[model samples]
Target: MQIPEVGEPAPGFTLPGTTVRDGARTDGEYALAAEIGRTVVLAFYPGDATPVCTAQLCSYQEELDDFGDLGAVVWGISPQALDSHAAFAHGSSLTFPLLSDPAGDVVRAYGLVAPGIGLRRSVFVIGPDGVVRWRHVGLVGLRFPKAATIRAQVEQLVA
Candidate 1:
């Protein structure tokens, strides 16, 4: 499947995930369609607790308020199991949902499966209208866009 381009409707998906709510870990399903009417950030990473992935997500968490200020909610997707996601979210102090796509179904749907590496580090910003407003798919999986950059894209969606 091809990655959804800017101006195209983002591929909708629902996946079981872990979230930190009220200082507690909660398990639930996260559905993209349910987040309609709000900007959604879909972040696909390779694994849980990996150095680069850790840094990328931690940075996002730190700037989460900026995204929230724009009414954008961020969701992180990975092939790791729910247990791993829960532990990673706790260890990294991430408040966003960490979705588990163990089957790689959602990953493949987003065209983010990195042939031999599992999944590529990618971020897609979806507008309130369900259209993709911006995206960044890392070519080498060694770097990710900073939170400020993504926040700017979300800001545009709201503007």
Candidate 2:
């Protein structure tokens, strides 16, 4: 299936995740409607502990403040379980929420599933009104944006 086009409402998700900072397993229901008043960044990756994914996630973690300042909530999603997510969170010192979509529900909803792999590297920028404002599907052989580029996008969206 083709990727969800821009301007579409981001598919909502509610999945169980373990709180890394507190060591508590909890359900995180991330609905587009719930974030209607604030921008939401759903960064999907293939897996945790991998090099490319690590770099991508770390970049997101490093820019948490900028995103927050723009009134945006960022969530990292992968097929990994809560425990793996917890480890990835702790290992990378991630400050945002890392959601576990073990059953690929969210992935399929967003049409981000790679044919032979898992989740593809994609970023969905859901505007404050719950409409998708921007999306980038993988670096795809180009030197995709670093933290600065993403921050710029957030600033532009909130501006």
Candidate 3:
């Protein structure tokens, strides 16, 4: 499946995930459709605790307040189990949710499945209206967009 383009409706999904709340790991189902009226950032990474993925998510966590100020919620998705996500979030002190896509269902839905990598490092910013406003899909998983760049994209949506 081709990735959703900017101005196109983001594919909706509900995935079980783990999030850090008050320094505790909580498990729940996150539904994209439930976030319809809010700007959402969907970040797809290859795995949890990997070097690049760690740096990428931690950087986003550092600027999480800025994203919150812009009314955007960020979600990290990977083809790992919930236990792995919980451990990664706890070890990394990640406050945002890390969704478990063990079957790669959501990854396939977003057209981010890579041959050996499982999933590409990608980020999609969805506007409050549920349309994709900006995206970056890494051909090589070594790098990812900076938090400021993603914030700017969300800012454009609300501006």
Please, what is the whole-model Cα lDDT of each candidate in the order they appear?
Answer: 0.92, 0.76, 0.93
Best by TM-score: 3
- The alpha-carbon deviation from the true structure for residue 111 of candidate 1, after best TM-score superposition, in angstroms, is 0.8
Local accuracy of candidate 2 as per-residue lDDT tens digits, 1-159: 457787877676676655455554454655557677898888888888888888888887888888888888888888898778878888877767788888898888887777667767888888887778888887441233576777777788867
Clashing pairs in 1: none
Name the lDDT value of residue 108 in candidate 1.
90
Q: Give per-model TM-scores.
A: 0.97, 0.87, 0.98
lDDT of 2: 0.76
User: Across residues 10-45, which tens digit of lDDT does each residue of candidate 3 receive?
Assistant: 999999989987778889999999999999999999
Quote the positional error of residue 125 for candidate 2 in Å.
Answer: 0.5
* Model 3 pairs whose backbones collide: none
